[model samples]
Target: MNDNFENLFENSEYSKTIKKGQLIEASVIEITDDHAVLNAGLKSESFVGLNQFKNPGGEIEIEVGDSVKVVIEEIENGDGTTRLSRQKAKNETTWSNIIRAMNEDEIIEGHIQTRVKGGFTVLIDQINAFLPGSLVDVRPVRDTQYLEGTVSEFKIIKAERKTNNIVVSRKGALQGDSLENKSEIISKLTEGQIIEGIVKNLTDYGAFIDLGGLDGLLHITDIAWKKIKHPSEILSMADKVKVKIISIDREKFRVSLGLKQLDEDPWKKIISNYEIGNKIDCMISNITDYGLFVEIEEGIEGLVHVSEINWTNSNPNPYKIANIGDQVTVMILDIDNEKRRVSLGIKQCKDNPWDSFANNNNIGDKITGKIKSITDFGIFVELDGEIDGLIHISDISWNNEDNIDLSQYKKSDEIESSILAIEAKRQRISLGIKQLNKDVFMEFNQSNSKGSIVKGIISEVDEKNALVLIENEIKGILNISEVSRDKVEDMRTVFKQNDEIEAKIIGSDKKNRTLKLSIKAKEEKEEREAIDSYKADEKESISKTSLGELLKSKFKKD
Candidate 1:
């Protein structure tokens, strides 16, 4: 009994020394409707509110004999017990662990609990730590929602022990890889090194190639020798391509790539297979204004110029002559391997007509022809064969002007002409019809003076004149004024055509082949005098007859 009393007095002294607001470890003894009795030694038994121990649904979170660390607030409330809180004790322990982690700059492993605007919340040991958006990935992640519930390594970027705040960086891990992996890939890449890569991203100028652990730029210009409008025309994302490294910068880890250099140049083998004057068949691959380009073989092209299609005819428009897919045979006239030019021709396959014409005909020969066509300058007359001649307007007639209408001479009019000139090289023949007739004026001028008299038949008559065909070839115009000098009012009354009359040449123009004739003055004067003499004789004879009759009658009466 003495030991029990000593123990009670000792406990009372310890409880008096333990003040309110002191932390104590206690076990829940009993749970009632509104309170839970907790045993905290040396202090009085603590009563925790049921609101703190029970969940909102009225179920007890802490059962009897469950040890809990709590804070005491009241010593007695008419029940010789103290008030305690378990939630406050748990909050203090959570804050103490978070503050220690922040001060040491330690990365605490956590699960992503939820997401925020710029980042996600990581539950690190029941403390929410901020993982920024930029620090979420080694590169960059567009959607943070994908990162929720995903575990990754990160570095602590911001930490404050006082505020218990922490921030982590995943980008720092990505930057560290650049310094370590970039040099390793570059040094192993040599010139002419063939490597496999994946097309990561496509751009207008180039593509970003991922060479396993490193990245290299693949420029669009190096994709192919042939023209490509865009990078997507040749490459696409995630496409596997084998590329040869042309150059490498070990310091910067830059690589230059070439796809075409792996193959042989097609032009090098093209020169040996063909030569000039080689008659080859080719397809018309392209049609241009100046020529048609033909592909004789793969990557080997030759040009057939517009002039070389047919030498006889001017180049027809390409649409009329050849289509896009037409196959043609062209003669190779020239080949220059160094210049990469092949000149071809179509006319070289046929015999030239001008060369054949030069061998057949000569000048000054008589050619019988029929008028085939007429132009402004001359008439085209075709001979028996394919031969034709031109009779210029000046060579048609000696007394005729070139302005004379030629429609009267229709096609198939037979005419004899002397071949004036023959240009066989030029494939031309010049003929003259007037040369077939004797030049009477030329002959007359050579034999006689300019004023010599000439006689001919009047062959043509007009309103005020007549044309005398002097010696069949030469002609002279008899104007109405020159035909009579007796004030002849009209031309038809005085002189009749085809009458056998003679006249002197008052004037002559040998070069012009013209003569002037007159008959009115002498013929009119002689006619008047003869008429007067006849009238006088008739009157005298009548008087004599009357006198004789009177004498005869008197003699009969005696």
Candidate 2:
């Protein structure tokens, strides 16, 4: 028996020397409920905990005659057994893999185990590695809990077996994958290609979409056919959407995407769908100081300018008449297809009161209306059917006076007037209240003649002349030299308002409606008549009496 044992020991695989902390290949010799026996080139069979050979779910993964790599923790023990560890073996192998990955610039898979100070701890196989917060992902992670227990690929940036230090980067791996994806996507990308993507972020000018590992810009204008102030109005973060590729820059890795290009342009057939003067119902979409924007159809809108809101009001307030979300009827006045603009008018759908009024009335037609508004220059009269006619201050009376106050014609006061003119294009009506009466100058011209005596009252007096009101409302002028047949410095001193006086008309201008009166000529004519009468009396007395009786009367008078 002794001779047979020596022969077996000399040829056995464990006859070679083995040391602790050394890795060696082993084979499972036996397995039990609590322990596993492994032949690891040792003098005696090594025993390890059975749990080491079991998976996380407590299921045995190793059986008899199965091969595995193990680390020797003890060469010999007092119990006549060698100590071996499967976990230690796995940890050493994991460190070797990580170091190799770092050298070869390869990626390894790992699970984020837990968050630690300044970073997170990741478990790769059975070894723990450090993952800095900055290297976790391409974007900053607000909550580290989200990454816990999640399996992700990582790039080993550093590895040290002496100090048991290892560092990995998720961001580096993602960046490498992104570069590959970007290059491939750019090579295959063509204009007009439809693709799906997730909305990554939104900005004032546009939205960024993520197509797998690449990012593209979706401009705000391409979001829809209608006008939008921002991209958030139509899309939100992380929304999935289908978009068309508009352009691509290979060198810059820039892509432009469009969502509206997938649909037909609404303005392409606008002319065929709508015509001038066609009435349509629309909803107010927006309001501005200049006009109202009404949407006639989806993605199609027209402008109802302030001037087109009403016939009478040239400067109408669009907000006062309509608001956002209000429905209204409008007429298509004009359309420019190339510009994609439609000029709409709310009043065009209704009866134009000015046009109707002009058709019914002619020049010199008498009409009665209420004063709608009064100003220093004119008064606006509201006629029938909401038509307004302007009665200028000069047309209010026969006299042309600059200081004619229009305050007397209050708003809503009844007044009679005649239409003098109509400007259809400008939507203006000229009216005259004084035109209802005959012109006073025409009557005065028929009765008065030059060099005729007339009586008048001083209506206005100035330094140069006195304005006199003659018969039939005729106005006359008397110069200062003609006042009282005497030289006068100022006519205002010789004449007072409403003073009655007699004078001779020296000049009469029928066209100008002016009569020139002279008091000096009248006084001179009366003086000459008195002298002639005295001469006639003296001649008769002399003829009746005699030369001697006349001499004696002269001597007595002396």
Candidate 3:
């Protein structure tokens, strides 16, 4: 060997110890169109493909003196050249990262390259790993092509060196990051902080607002100062709204928001603007079976219960009287500040019809009305001012000792009656059709009480009893036994309809309007009178005979 060659070998890394399957640090010496020359502290420089030094962006990133890790494939090939592999060197490092991430539950970065069977191919460092479709995101993704060539963090769930198998979850890494970010966000939140955000989603009870990357709940009750049925009533999806933070729970990552807090609470000004008996014109926002909910102002409302809807009607139907969005005048009946409640009355806004009627009319005044309805107990007559007067069944007729056929009157039938009573506060008006004429019932009842002998005409006869008309208006019931002082098995044989018969008044029922008559009692009373008369006449005759006999004896002695 020459002196120059001997000195070169002594100073070169080739003599320092080089072997195949060994990783060593190398530096770029020169670059060409297709390849780069690297020096691994060896006597001879080796060539590497330029594509190996190119970054994922397809840009040539190599420069002179750039240190790289390369594995020796052969220290000396048949051509007497050093052979090294860059990809193999990177594979060893990639395995180390994957094993560490799996064992320590750490996150690693990867580039999603392409779609594969049942998953995507992720390049972690330089090693290929399987990323399942379900692991791409926190939620299911219909299209994963958008993730290609993008760098994302991942958690290695499984790894096997023998088969070179590795599995990673992007969702797991994202969830971990979300938890940390959520904690930071919640910790910084202060209650009552007004924030502008976009509405993310709406449910029946609330809406979820996106405060930057964090989500907060806006309950339906807090969405507006007025009552609402759902969150959608005031907000929609993706609507931009300013909300106030009502509450925050850092540990649970929960935040309560209120949209109405952005505006002045209308209830705070309610007392200043309204008081009991204050009449306000407003629109009916909602109508339920029980009441009408009217808006006093924006975000302020009052309830008018069915009872307060009218003054004359005992059971006023809310739906029948009003509808949603109807303009109406209501008087404030009560106010509850703490509960944010107001009791209202539709009838209080105007003069009560009952009171007006009472003031305008007097008892016994003649009234013309149309029958509004007929019930079992009474007939409702619609009188003046749409007010109704009840004509009870008992007051409907003066001659219904038998019965008054209610079918004679119908709805919208015009009739005349006299006002019997007026109870304004109780919301009742009593009328009597019989009062338009004389009350023969009262006179007949007074004149012929119990034990009074009265002549009556038989109006009806049945197997059990007979009906007889007294004073041509009142009728009394005469049982079969009362017809005669005998065991009468069949009342039909003893009496018939339209037959004239005299009887004594035995009993009376004012509620049922019945008078019991008895022919047997009348006959017994007549017999007693005749016996008393006969006894008085017989005693007078005896006294006269005794006086005549004494006078005749005294005349014979003279």
The candidate that achieves the highest TM-score relative to the unseen native structure = 2
Each prediction's total of clashing residue pairs, residues at least 3 apart in sequence or on different chains, is: 0, 0, 1
lDDT of each: 0.70, 0.84, 0.84
lDDT, residue 512, candidate 1: 67
The Cα error of candidate 3 at residue 231, in Å, is 4.1
User: Model 2: per-residue lDDT, tens digit, 112-180?
Assistant: 898899898998886889998998989887877888888999987656677778888899788875556
lDDT computed for candidate 1: 0.70
Off by over 4 Å in 3: 1-178, 196-198, 229-242, 312-324, 400-402, 439-558
What is candidate 1's CA lDDT for residue 439? 72
- On residues 255-340, what C-alpha lDDT tens digit does candidate 1 reach at each position? 87876666766667657777777788888878888888888776567888988887455465665799877889889899887787
Q: Model 2, poorest ten-residue lDDT window? A: 1-10
